[model samples]
Target: MSLRKRLIACLDMTDGRVVKGTRFADLVDAGDPVGLCLRYAADGADEIVILDIGATVDARPALLALISRAAAVLDIPLAVGGGVRSYDDAAAFLDAGADKVSINSAALADPALVSRIAQRLGSQSVVVAVDAAAHEGSWRVRSVAGTLETGRDAVAWASEAVERGAGEILLTSIDRDGTRSGYDLQLTRAVADAVRVPVIASGGAGSAADVIAVLREGGASAALLASLLHFGMVRLPELKARLAESGVEVRRPLPAPRPEEVAAWRG
Candidate 1:
């Protein structure tokens, strides 16, 4: 039997507020990052990922204060990323509250940065995030919050990142991001197959069925959700129930009260 697939919630932040956008553009307010982090954890999200989307572009550090606040409320593992350019940057996130720190563009700019951070904090504490966009039938890595194309193959970068001491991969599809279509199964399968570490499939999650599809057909060890969960389209328990029925091993959450039950209880 395989390990139980994880359900992770992604909170994309801009200026300390949760935001969502289509194809990484057209930003819209979602909710409070800290509040959502706690809600997701209580609702049974296996892990929580908070990415400061603007940190890199603004030439600032990862939102350590925001990360610390979320981490304080999160019962599950908290992964923080964005503007992690050096060992000290990664260390600060860990010292503040993050369980794992994710490095993206900075890792691409200096591949050694991944190893440096891993050497100090342990590989398990480092997650290499790859944002890829479909280009000429192949996926190329994107950087600076999906604005710059690095011309690096997503699968190749993933394998190399793992070799350099990254314990896991947070692979996000730039094209599919915020689209709610579904995950890029081929892209996820390619990276997951090429890498020894766990791959968390992100972008394009629309429904509970989409989560099941990604975990089963995409060969992903986990799925990261944003729009659907943020918009109240699907809850964690509903997703886990769907995955269980599809014969996918999942960390089943406690039963949630039905709408009518809640209404009656409230009265």
Candidate 2:
């Protein structure tokens, strides 16, 4: 059986509002988290990721309420990240219905936390979110909402994350984020090559072709989209169709809307 390309929609939350931006600057509100996630789920997204953009710095609740609302409405898997600094925080998200907790700054600060969370929950439930930027001819890991540079190579960190029990790695290129150009293929491949677990590529996905490139050339198992999907620039079904035509494995498309169903909605 051919490996299927996973489609993941990312929800960047700030002040309880869904926001989208390029390169993590000038973020504009997209919509309410719950409503947006529900729409994506209905549109056939395989999984959803919620990142509390302000949680880590503000020390506020990591939008558990939003997560609960999303989990109640969407049937697919939900991964919550940002400001999850402790085991309690991770547990809170899980209890609120998140299938996985993505740790970034916290995990980098204390690598042992990954193992602890995996032990308490399970290896499959822990994801290490690595925000990396191309610097000085190398991809260095960044933390604290991409503000601080850790001086560590992206590939090495990804390897360590897996050893510490991270089942998945959500690798984002801060430089390519919001560019709508394409992914940083070298960075994606480096992390994917260093890690044994699944790698979800983020940043620089402007078109369906970008998604295809990430999976095939970057060695990413999945691709996470934000601006493209949030702004309706790329519809899920259309993108899936393109992927299918390109010989990429994707989930079957939903049946076409029946005449009566469309009319009823219109009425």
Candidate 3:
């Protein structure tokens, strides 16, 4: 983990609209995908991630227009995921204007794809997403949007993915997703310690303290937030201020957002 922490806003999309769910169920529309992303970037998000949550299950690729439109205006990096099954798939995503392509189900099924994309596009452009769920007593890797268990240990799989050329790990805890309690510190620290690449901890960010806990005690390089930021419960600038106040090294948060901007959209 780096001394300087990163704050990322993730827009989980399905059917062109940004959506969020409790533990990936009973999804509700968050906002317009492109519009929300623009707001997050302008509000001081370090990176904006647009994930096509339904692509894999639908046997389709991520929406290109959404990525292109959002990427066109943002200066910050944009990473996208879902339905990336091959090198060509990833390359097409980059062509659509994404800074990085994240692969979850595909990576687990064919680990070689990670190396293939890394070999041609460079590891820094590849993000391997690991979604894990707590089993009887340990964490197991889940695939297809955390719906199916692959019987693989989360920590070990993360290590293999990194060795195979993944530049970073986007780790999401299925149990904690949308709970708004906090990130799974034990799961995060275990994977962070096992892998050499930076781990972007995802799920259950309800407050600034939760963010601080993951970056510090959880040993994550970055915190990936969705519901909290999407719903306006925690503004990015204020969150960064709280982080800095707690002694976590972070970029000075941008000034408070205008009233009109906040009224325009929560995401």
Candidate 4:
């Protein structure tokens, strides 16, 4: 297996538009989802995770049209989620050009959905998303656009998801999301250690060093980026080069940085 850690771009969507919010609220427009996905794919992002952050609250379905459009342009894998409530919902996403279907609230409501999707579509095609926030000295799982706290221990839920056939865990720290403070290494490491499957650390990532810290010290197999990439804080190639320089294995063919960009990254 490749030891190269993955760098994933996360596009949170609401009403078909890419947007991001601080701690899952006060969302503002970022860009078009399809355009961003295509750009990330071309820029050497290992994968793209498109989440309809409002779907569950709006009582809408997953963004099938957006997924189809993104899949058409993306040569890399696409993982789509949000408002995936049943096995049929998960299957529809896969049929709509999603390489994998991510289940969040639905999985929490009915753990059987994870196993059913894996049994039908294969575990490799299932990604379980855990949006957790620190609560009372421990992390609690939140769902329904992060408005509801299930009181489930984050690490225990991660292990249970894996046992239910989730091939990977997308662990997002609700406390750090969109803050650019840094990833919650304590939360990430706890979940990563609890699960044998790959854990994609999401949420805070203000600098390249934050990502490297998660991969090297937090024990994550991948890092999910949002505000950093969405707001032009750091280019994917520049970030990958920085990681490689720090002894992190990453996919090659990273573009040579322009002198100006290099200076910008350093500055």
On residues 27-142, what C-alpha lDDT tens digit does candidate 4 reach at each position?
A: 34235788778778878999999988778544344378778888988989999888888998888888889999889988999999899999989999999999999988889999
lDDT of 1 by residue, 3-110 (tens): 889998888888877776233222342356776777778889999988887785443443777777887777789998878889998898999899999999899999
Evaluate candidate 2 by giving its C-alpha RMSD to the native, one decimal. 6.1
lDDT of 3 by residue, 32-54 (tens): 77767767777788898988877
Worst 10 residues of 2 by lDDT: 21-30
Q: Between candidates 2 and 3, which one is better according to TM-score?
A: 2
TM-scores for candidates 1 onward, in order: 0.87, 0.88, 0.87, 0.87
Given candidate 2, what's the lDDT at residue 140? 95
Every candidate's CA RMSD? 7.0, 6.1, 7.1, 7.5
Worst 10 residues of 4 by lDDT: 21-30
Candidate 2 colliding pairs: 22-178, 23-177
* Model 1 TM: 0.87
At residue 114, candidate 2 shows an lDDT of 94
Worst 10 residues of 1 by lDDT: 21-30
Model 1: C-alpha RMSD to truth? 7.0
- lDDT score of residue 26 within candidate 4: 27
For all candidates in order, the CA lDDT equals 0.86, 0.87, 0.87, 0.87
RMSD of candidate 4 to true structure, Å: 7.5
